[model samples]
Target: MTELPDTRLFDTVLVANRGEIACRVIRTLRARGIRSVAVYSEADAGARHVREADQALCIGPAAAAESYLNIAAVIGAARASDAQAVHPGYGFLSENLEFAKALEAAGITFIGPNIEALNVMGDKIRSKNHVAAAGVPVVPGISEPGLTDADLIAAAADIGYPLLIKPSAGGGGKGMHSVFAAEELPATLATARRVAAASFGDDTLFLERLVANPRHIEVQILGDTFGNVIHLGERECSLQRRHQKVIEEAPSPLLSGLDDGGAVRARIGAAACAAAASVNYTGAGTVEFLVSDDTPDEFFFMEMNTRLQVEHPVTEMVARVRGKSLDLVEWQLRIAAGEKIDFTQQDVTLEGHAVEARVYAESPAEGFLPATGTVVVLEESVAQRPGVRVDSSLARRLKITANYDPMLAKVIAWGTDRREALDRLDAALADYVVLGVPTNVEYLRLLVADPDVQAGRLDTNMIERKLPDMAFRTVDAGDYAAAALAARKVDVARPNAPGEAPAASSWGRLDGWRLGDPAPWRSAWAAPGRTGVVTVSGPQADSGTEGPGVVHVNGIGGDQESRTALDLNGTTGGELLWDGQERGYRVGMLGETVFLGSGGWSVALERLDREAATARMLAGLEREDAAADPQLRSPMPGTVTVVNAKTGDRVAAGDVLLAVEAMKMEHQITATMAGTVHIGVAVGALVKADQVVATVEPDEDNSTTIPEGE
Candidate 1:
């Protein structure tokens, strides 16, 4: 064990991260009255963390390698800001042992486990061996560093056919593969090796017996310099996609077991505490376990996270119920300064259930591929119910980039019981809004509403088996209607600068005006799956209004008797009335064109510019034609896998140009127009869908005779 420093160290700390985690740490630092500094990349200059911190500095470019992950730059920022410590918020350098050592060398506090602890746990195989030696029941597997093909096959037989081939030094589900049968062993092992090499620079492999439909339960463990350690209960993290957790809830239903009196719960919690004690772990850490519901009496160790988890909010909620703030960030800072745990393990108590859903900017239908774009719209409803909370780091104009994890925000809801907590979560998800880039909001809705999920019968494969349809349902018509209507309203009321046209009259005038004729009125329209349209009609009244006159849509048909004092007012300003209900509509006129708003869709009532409209119409038609023609284009957006043709090579219509892979699925691009090959894009070049990969120059002068189909 390492020696502890004196208490009350570090005046100011710099957070070397972006987005919600940065904001989260800053909030805690302020509560402790510690001066906090925030560092940002070029892309995150105007981010929420930059605004929230007491001081902010620009580190480097947007790419993580140069900005967030650049140890020198981060250390330089810390020195420049006179910061006494650096807090790595989760990703980037959070788990980097070298970064921790660098901070120590600089005489700065690293607010996490010491470098030795990180080095040990950083390697999965090594960590597993240590924990197994400490009496924790790890999954049945080989702990060898490297594995040959023969070794893998032999290990698979020992662990049984359905085994997990995982990188010995990997996390977040990357560099991991599950093999169901013996025939798939070679290919799965190869893929796992490649991913491991690319991601962690460690192609070392380990085989573990696959736990079928296992619940991912992790115990929150915190230790201090004095050897005091405790488990803050367990979190159920079974809802996942692409091996990344989507939803997390604390006080797992599995912990309750089928029997009462907390007998099994106590046993599991004791084991978790023992696991942490074995590591001599200090500060905030988590011990993950893969629990099989079929074998309720037994559970095996999965891994140990040496830092604060991404889903730490659930633990925070549990801590709040005990009338004490967990304050993980503050604790880490103090621990780095050598503060011991003052309270005993009995002080910690697991309270109400809290659930968190990670909102990511990605296309769920496209294998959850990360998406990057400006957030055009973002809204989350305020929590009106008690015991509910929300955590987010997005605004209306926040930009999501591809340099880091795709997670945009995390929505956490808490309640006195599991059912109420779930209800609050469902409501919050419904009210949550994010536009521009595709999100998994609707997919989350499906998961929350799932019967298995509600009944707490969740597992790692819950999403894969339960919601196969979710991968294809990209367009939610209701969401489209809401976005469209909101956009239209914004456009109509927008102010014009000098020399711009004035606002038009709210209502239109009709030609017929008689003593027995009906009065005019306006009507607001709304359709869930379609565009909204507004209609106006009534007797003509020649009152001088700024723009158009009001016409009653209800009185379009001539009724002999007057009903409900219906009267037409051509000069009436403000908003228009549709059958007594007021609909907010703004009409404007520019030159001879009159603009009318019907939700997001609008209509311009003026003589159309024949030439300009024709040009636009033709352009649209040509674009559509190009999109529909697949004969001379790339199949999908990806890097070119191979180049099969040369500039002067003669190629047939069915010849292959190159292959592309998107989200790990391969697609082949083929030649459709037969002629001399003119290769444009080369191998290893990036291309988008429908982009011209290669062009075939048609042979002239009967050099190439037309085929029968041609």
Candidate 2:
């Protein structure tokens, strides 16, 4: 660990990130009596991070580029708030070397790795060279710049048939391509280059020898100015998709060699420690390695992440087990202020096993398509059982947008051993409920229960290979059944229905039926792709007692046994079974019609003439049809940012029509098509919800052509 000057650090520090990381940092800072400041964009003004900070500043617009990634704005906010230090929490500008330098120039302490260390580690080629020169085993590959196709081909051939073409400046799996055959080189390289340019602003790439069936292991290292560096064991980040890790755990099951106490684990940890010391690295960083399961001796350098990783909580758990609190943010701040590590490597200890699963707002069934919507109901296990931890920033009624990463939260579980940890993790996931948006929770649950995962035989390709059916598995049948049952109960207990029975039978009827006062019932019904409303009513009664209800479909009374009977005069409604189980229903009036609760269905009474009723139904259908069309305009004012199709373009059903950029994030407008595009709105234009963004001309000969422009 490096040593630092003996001086007190800043009184206040500003956190320049959002979500759970920001909240986590603020809690630590407050506990230490260090004032914490926060910065938020427009969309995050009401976010948890903003509310938790001691003080907060509105940086800029909601787009990450305009706010979180706006280096200038962040520096200005730090200056205005009089914060002596700036903490870039995990993402955003955390690993950005230039941002660190800018803070230095402004005389504000940056709570992370120094600029020199960041510059070295930020560039993959430079970091690899430094690590290799330090006698650390590096992956066999070519890092030299400017290689032609022939040169790359020869290098690939030399490294063996299967190799990885990774962008020198890439992380998060973008611009990463694996090739097992020579013929796939050119196309893969092109894609890698394009992805690299888009993600990292650099097209420089390198080739690395690929290890077959390798576990992704990384060691957490901490260094201070005093030249003291210690390794805090390793984390297993083997569960990945498109090179992005979805789940991580500490004290790797693979490292323990199936819990048999293997010699390979100690050697790998030592090698990781050596890699960190080689670069003279200081502050919190991770040295990642790829370990082949088939051959223990075949471990090689993968990459080095220069900042605290997204999965840092697992490492924190390990530290807790050692009876010591390790604050990565504090370590960086103290080191930058000239503090040396107070403890030696042998002083650190590893404890219980911890597992972390990233909960993302993405649709696994839709090829992991990122989703955005209001989180109407976000529920987790109410009881925090032993060895369980949930790190999240989600709350009920929060909106998820497409402007940033889709990760909603990270759920971690800790136990004395791996099995216990795995068990806890599975339970936590099973109890989590996130409604109003698509998520991959169900998919993760399935993965954790897999035989390979349970056995700890993990690799980067584990999810892809073993859970091939995961993308199509949306809901667990048991969970769906439970939700359905709950929904039914809610509908039945509603008080709006006159004929609906109360849960308690204490209230007795005051009189016999002349006719029960008419009451309306509103109930909703939902299936896989269909939803509808059904309403029923009980007749007027002078005795104040409601009789069995009569069902009405669009105001027309059903010719059955009063549709379904309700025990209004008794405790608990008579079992009203639909599909299965006795569910309750409540009723209310909407205009002249009645709505049935317990099922969210509505019906209207046909008091008008037959001709008038038919006319009304047609009008209602037109309105419903218009509302269901996806080619409509935005409900609020916004700018058009994405135009997916043009005139004469052929489109399939459910293809995106365009995107509206409102409040900084983009909202895609999709096409409900079985035809060709006849008209569409241009990009950079303003739109409203019913405003037609595009018109589709059906392929059938009777198709009508809409106007060129709205």
Clash number for each model: 11, 54
lDDT of each: 0.67, 0.68
For residue 281, model 1's alpha carbon misses the true position, in angstroms, by 1.3
Residue-wise C-alpha lDDT for candidate 2, range 572-661, written one tens digit per residue? 122343333344533322222222222211111212334554555675577565423424455434567667688888876566677765
lDDT of 1 at 549: 33
Write one digit per residue (lDDT tens) for candidate 1, span 1-710: 12224544578999988888998999878877789999999988878889899999998997677999899999999999999988888878988988999999999888888676798788888888888887888899887776786798877887796888888875889867888999999888877786677567789988999897788888887788788887777888988866789999988877764575267666777788887787677888888889887876678988888888999998888664245657667677777778877666677777788999888766555455445555654556544556666666777667666556667788888888888888888888766666545577766767887888889888898788876654333222222222222222333335555565454422322322335534332223222111222222232222212233333221113221111111212211124333445443323333333333322222223322446445545654765554122235654456665677788898765666666544333355665545777778786687775577776665453243322112
Candidate 2: segments with Cα more than 4 A from true spot: 1-8, 148-154, 258-262, 320-325, 380-383, 471-528, 532-710
Tell me, by TM-score, which candidate is best: 1
Model 2 TM-score, 2 decimals: 0.75
